[model samples]
Target: MAGLLQRVKSKMAIFAHRKARGMLDGEYGSVFKGRSLDFDDLRGYVPGDEVRDIDWKATARHGSPLIRRYAAVRRQTVLLVTDTGRNMAAEARSGEAKKDIAVLALGVLGYLAHRHGDLVGLVCGDSTATRSLPAKGGEAHLERLLGHVDSHTSLDAAASRIQEQLEYTARTIKGRHLLFVVADEIAADDAMAQLLRRLRAQHEILWLTVRDADLAPYPLTGQVPSAEVDYCSVADSALLPWQPAASAAVKAAYTRATAERDAARRAMLRAAGITEGEVAGSGDVITGLFALLERHRRAG
Candidate 1:
């Protein structure tokens, strides 16, 4: 775990020192454009004005529609919510552990927050237990928060009740905040969707899903000798031999199913007004995060 922290810190150091005119810097400006509670002024309502932002009282008095504008707050609150369940412990195709990828992802965001002098906090747990750290500033506090996450995360933990974590966050956190949720490739169910809707109403949300190795595309080879593979879950564990060959049709079907699932997940997140990024456990987490942030920057 110490080595993992050191590696993450090293990577983040590079990111932190990058030139202000770099792609990441530009994107960060556009993506996080002026999110603040400080009111700037009132203006004539535009066609795309958010209904919630409209000053109805002012409009009635002036007999004209008006909208309130706010300057982006310099110091923002950043919260990292992670699911440390058994599924997150699985190995990726690159042979790197999913938990490690998750930690790297968290580190990237936490370091960014620290650099900006923003308050950083965390909400992480599995089905067995959940933990939270209140938002605080300073590099030392951020290090302690990351260390706690590293110590508590376990692959042998029970299935994650992600909804419970969300509930806890919604209940405890007040005011507007930037929320980053890191978890496995689990689709949003109805209950989860409802919870996300509520949270999105109050906070800016970014979802990062760690891709599962089993879902990666593989070339089909002719039938070969069977090999033993270990399969374990919260309920049981076993090592069983299985055929290596998969027919082209089976491969195509699997690919289609994976695509459809991904599409559905994307749609669900969009509906909740949340941007999402998928990071393969075996891939460079920093690169993936940069891509995600770039996409959001472009969209914004």
Candidate 2:
């Protein structure tokens, strides 16, 4: 079967290409607009009316003053860091795997960032950090970012590496923007915590993690190819031939490893004060963006 990245890349292109309309959430993307005035009800005031919105003629007739209220301005820059490590490909968590979910999540986030008029960029890597796209705005630029995320691959899965990447990201970004780190697992606790403390101090940071169901205890679809395989999940890389006789045991071990990684991720995020969104194999892009937007509002 084709990998999850390939599948989601084909699917999300359609959603991102569509022209956004009405509210941002309407297009299944996050919307960022400037300090546009929000209409609030008019109310009579005894003081602080600066002689504005006070129907002078009506006030003259009623002998009173009134004013209107508006919501605060909206201003933010966004930087997205995507971790495409081997941990994502582990068969432990969900049957669908983590890499697939992470890719789709990035596509959705890119769409929303474009809607809000915020510059969008991506940092994709594995054992060693790879591509770096500077945050920029425009339909074409976002398309390039989407294309970039489509090609990423990683070698490692430690969350501690996040701090190193974040520092580099901070140096390159040059501005306080909302930071989104999309990864499947968060096992490197101490590293993640330090990164979060510093990142949140300078910018609003959010972690978007896609979780699979299989790791939480589920039946396995037993099938082991009786042939040499490209094994990508081993800590110290080694290739081995698959044997159908032990497929069941292999599946069990896979399940346990994935479960441990998932638990580690949840615990690490909780300790770091980072929130998580579960991205399923068939998660909704629009729904997730709306929830994220609501969270941003609450924070504001």
Best by lDDT: 1
Residue-level lDDT of model 1, residues 91-160, one tens digit each, is 6545577777888888777777776667889998887778998989877777777777666666667776
Predicted candidate 1: what Cα RMSD to the true structure? 4.4
TM-score of 2: 0.61
Report the lDDT tens digits of candidate 2 across residue range 59-109: 566666755544554535567787655655554244565655666677556
| Residue 294 local lDDT, model 2 | 60
Model 2 CA lDDT for position 170: 59
Q: After the best TM-score superposition of candidate 1, give how far the Cα of residue 173 lies from its true spot, in angstroms.
A: 1.6
lDDT of each: 0.73, 0.57
**lDDT at position 249, candidate 2:** 76
Instruction: Provide the clashing-pair count of each candidate structure.
Output: 0, 9
